[model samples]
Target: MKRITVIGSGYVGTAVACLLSTKNMVAVIDTDKEIIHKLSKQISHLDDPQIKKYLKKNKNNLKFSTELTSAISKTDLYILCLPTDFLVSKNEFDTKNLKSVISELTELDPKVPILIKSTVPMHFTDEMNKEFNRDDIVFSPEFLREGQALYDSFYPSRIIFGSKKPSLATKIASIFKEAAKNSPQVLFSSAAESESIKLFSNSYLAMRVAFFNELDSLCLSKSFDAKKIIEGVCSDARIGNEYNNPSFGFGGYCLPKDTKQLISQFKDIPNSLITSVIQSNEKRKKYISNKIIEKKPKNVGIYRLQMKEGSDNFKESSVINIIKKIKNHKIPIIIYEPLLRKQTFLNSKVMTNFTEFAASASIILANRYNEELNPYLEKTFTRDIFQEN
Candidate 1:
């Protein structure tokens, strides 16, 4: 079996390691001792059911460690799943961590192939290959969601490899193909094109979200039924009713940052739609906040902090933005999130007792509807048209 080392045991890396361990000897390396400790005991650090099952079933083939050097020495191939968070102040992605990982691996072994699964700016892979003087540095963008990471990996819609070495690219594709349950279309293209594919793909999803949200806003203003309008509009086969759900805005780990990164790339070129997508998302959040302000509640109750259902991530969740806006009005807010251990978040009180939280607020704001909020439906304000995240 092929030996693989996956670096960065976050959402993407953990899922990749579990999926590959089924047919290959995989070692997961991370700087976090707690993450390594949990993985070593066959316990998943992330909140994916599929990952938990696979980690348990493939415990014999999978290994976890905090020692990167030792893991690299034992592995034949390296997959870098490092973070590249977009920095708003710099108007670009902070790729320092990814560059550091590449430097370490090149020093360890220059001949071993390295596949970059981290999201980087366009032409980043090409520049890095030229800098290191190696062609085996491939850029394969990940398309997995936050909670459904392993499920998407097991049944990927497409597999793309960005490499100058066609033979090496084919071999890398073969490895993923062998691991996946279904035969996904594999495409080998230039590093720049592949990078553009990821950015544009996420940007399009953000745009669709913005489009439906704008429609909902117009319907609300006109006192029309948004659900009926959306149903009739989505009836067109070309539209194919999906992702038409309204929310505070499109805020997640990928969409917000990826769309901003793509806009940064349009520095020289004149474009309105690309720039408007970012503005539209912010406007949607502001519109939602304005609706909350119109209610003029003494205390507002936030049902959950997550961006969507089955996800523990709240990095850039739209509900957080709404909370910030509402805070500016000097209104008391209490958050009810079972996942939050802290008593206070962002200077607002976090209520562990759901009954007390519900009684304290005159109105509640929920980005996505849940059954737990059923008793307080009359006091709850939500824009979840499809009732699914």
Candidate 2:
């Protein structure tokens, strides 16, 4: 078994570490002590059920630590899954964390291969290789959902590796294929093309979401059935149904930031479609908030802050933007997020008690539907038609 160390314990890192540990001696390194502590006890920091299951079953093969030096000895492979959040002022993803990790890893072990699974800008792998003066850096973008990250890794739709060395790339692909449950299609390409693949793949999904959301907005304005219209449109075999669900907007860690980064890469190129996708998301949120304000309810209740049903991520969630818009209209708001520990969020009262929360709000806004809200369906406002996150 290869000795592998996965840096960063976020969703991507955690999922990859768990999957690789099934057949390898895996060391998971994170800067946060609490996250490392949880994993050391065979507990997953994320809300993914598959991750938790892996931790329970594969605990013997995995080790968790806050420092990389402890696990750097004789490590055969180093995978980086650090964060690359979009910086609005710079109009690109902030790669400081990714670079820091790479710098440290190269210094600690110059000969070991480095695999980057983070979402980066187009041609970023080339830039990093040139900057570090190393050709062993490979970019393998992860196409994973927030809550189902581990499951997706276990049965990936496809596997891709972007590298300068064909032999190294092939070896890395083999490692992933061995860990995966199914024999997924594998592709090897230039580092730049692989980087582009990651950005373009997410940009396309964001566009689809924007399309369906705009359609939903039009239906709301014209008093038509969005569900039936979507059903008819997706029934066509060419379109095939996926990612057509309407919500407050496409707001998660990946879609919003990745779409913006993709646009930045279009620097001098004439493009209206991608620009429209970003605008459409903002417009959809405005439309949703306006619909809520039109009710002029005394107390508006937010059912959850998560972007999806099974996720615990609140970063860039569209619901937060909706709350901000409604707050501007001086609407009294109350949030019912069981995950929230504080008494207030964004200056609004936070209630963990569903009974009190349901009784208080004249209208409760939910981005996704929940069975718990069935009794208060009349007072709840949601765009979840199929309810299948």
lDDT of each: 0.90, 0.93
What residue pairs clash in candidate 1, if any at all?
Answer: none
User: Which regions of candidate 1 deviate over 4 angstroms?
Assistant: none
TM-score per prediction, in order, is 0.98, 0.99
Error of 2 at 186 (Å): 0.5
Q: C-alpha displacement of 210 in model 2, angstroms?
A: 0.6
lDDT of 2 by residue, 26-145 (tens): 999999999999899987778889899999999999999998899877699999999999999899999988988888887888889999999999888888889989999999989989
lDDT of 1 at 38: 91
Cα deviation of 348, candidate 2, in Å: 0.8
Residue 340 of model 1, lDDT score: 88
Off by over 4 Å in 2: none
In candidate 1, what are the lDDT values of residues 172-212, reduced to their tens digit? 88889999998899988998889999999999999999999
